[model samples]
Target: MPVQRGYRQACGVARGLDIVGERWSLLVVRELLLGPKRFTDLQQALPGASPNALSDRLRELADAGVLRRRQLPPPGNTRVYELTTWGHDLEPIVVALGTWALAAPPTPEQIFVSADSAMLTIRTYYVPTPDQPAQTLQIDLRDHGPAGTFTAHLTSSGAAVAHEPPEQPDAVLVTTTEALLAAFGDDDVPGLVAADAVITGDADVVRRLLSSVHVPPATDPR
Candidate 1:
């Protein structure tokens, strides 16, 4: 499909925008950052995007070589959308864009974050220290439809989160995506427990992980 719109500029940023500046385009990229997702999965994660609009964005992205569609084998013969190598390069840009937004007005209290967005937020604010111990935390978002589990590995250098579970986790936290995101801000283990979060391992590890999240002060809009 021919690119629907063009800025007709030689600038790289302008060229980039020509490819992904359309509505819902980058959001599609965000959903696939961790792994491939079927059309239904993207629909669930981005409830606001209309099916037609989403399809258009997907087609445009694929045309731009940002993502590709593939079919799985065996009992799971399903088509899923995943980011291509060039598309995966957008991770830092997406992460940095999110970090930049945190300085603006806080997100409305009523806005619910998808599981992937919540995990990306953790990746955005997580701070690594030279003395911090290496450990893995299994996060189970119980309320998320199709309930998903992710593993977070913390090290002195960085923290990495994946969609798969860890073989041996130092701590396991069971909570809703909303509650988990809230914990990142307050480091409130008791509150999470009160909210019905199940802690199967050392809660301190959870606390330390939560405490290490640093959301910079929001910028005054004056």
Candidate 2:
């Protein structure tokens, strides 16, 4: 059969690339990975891209079967974009790309990353033992001791709600957004602090949380 213009030649890697090959195409997919989002949510996720372009890319993604629009049920229903089973197939590809980028990082200014991690940096709230009222909050490298890739997981009722190296996060707090995310699965928190990572959030919780979270030797600078 003849290959379609945008369709993957063998429905293999190339085809996968074809579907999400544009500048922000993969980014868009990444945002959707968190959960369903409205049009504005995606726009906010990508700071640089314009609305027209974002809309176009989303349309293309849907056409390629990478995602589909969903509607909420009777309670607090809202229109949102979500990945299909086919869309989920792209996860491995994205993760591989992340691993590759971490292996050899670029300079600081040229670095780029999604705001989700940025929020993870600033917005997340945590308590050290779930018994204390979040004392000893840390933000930026100066506040923390080392510089390296650090991953965090959320817990509730003494059970893990989320953790990294594989699972998605409400947000991923780190030093360098672009390179760090690329290096996340292989993180090292102490080294990240030693390297002067730009960190923000509940310092005490972050310190305690690290013990529970696991990062591969590479991502973690320490």
- Every candidate's lDDT: 0.84, 0.53
Question: Once superposed on the true structure, which residue ranges of model 1 sit more than 4 Å away at CA?
Answer: 1-3, 107-110
lDDT (Cα, tens digit) per residue for candidate 1, span 91-181: 9998888777767776667376788887777777788868878989999988775536888888888778888899999999988987777
- lDDT, candidate 2, equals 0.53
User: In model 2, which regions exceed 4 Å deviation?
Assistant: 1-11, 73-77, 115-205, 211-222
- TM-scores of the candidates in the order shown: 0.92, 0.55
User: Which lDDT value does model 1 have at 140?
Assistant: 91
Of the candidates shown, which would achieve the greatest TM-score relative to the real structure?
1
Question: By summed lDDT, which 10 consecutive residues of candidate 1 come out lowest?
Answer: 103-112
Q: Relative to the unseen true structure, what is the Cα RMSD of model 2?
A: 9.4
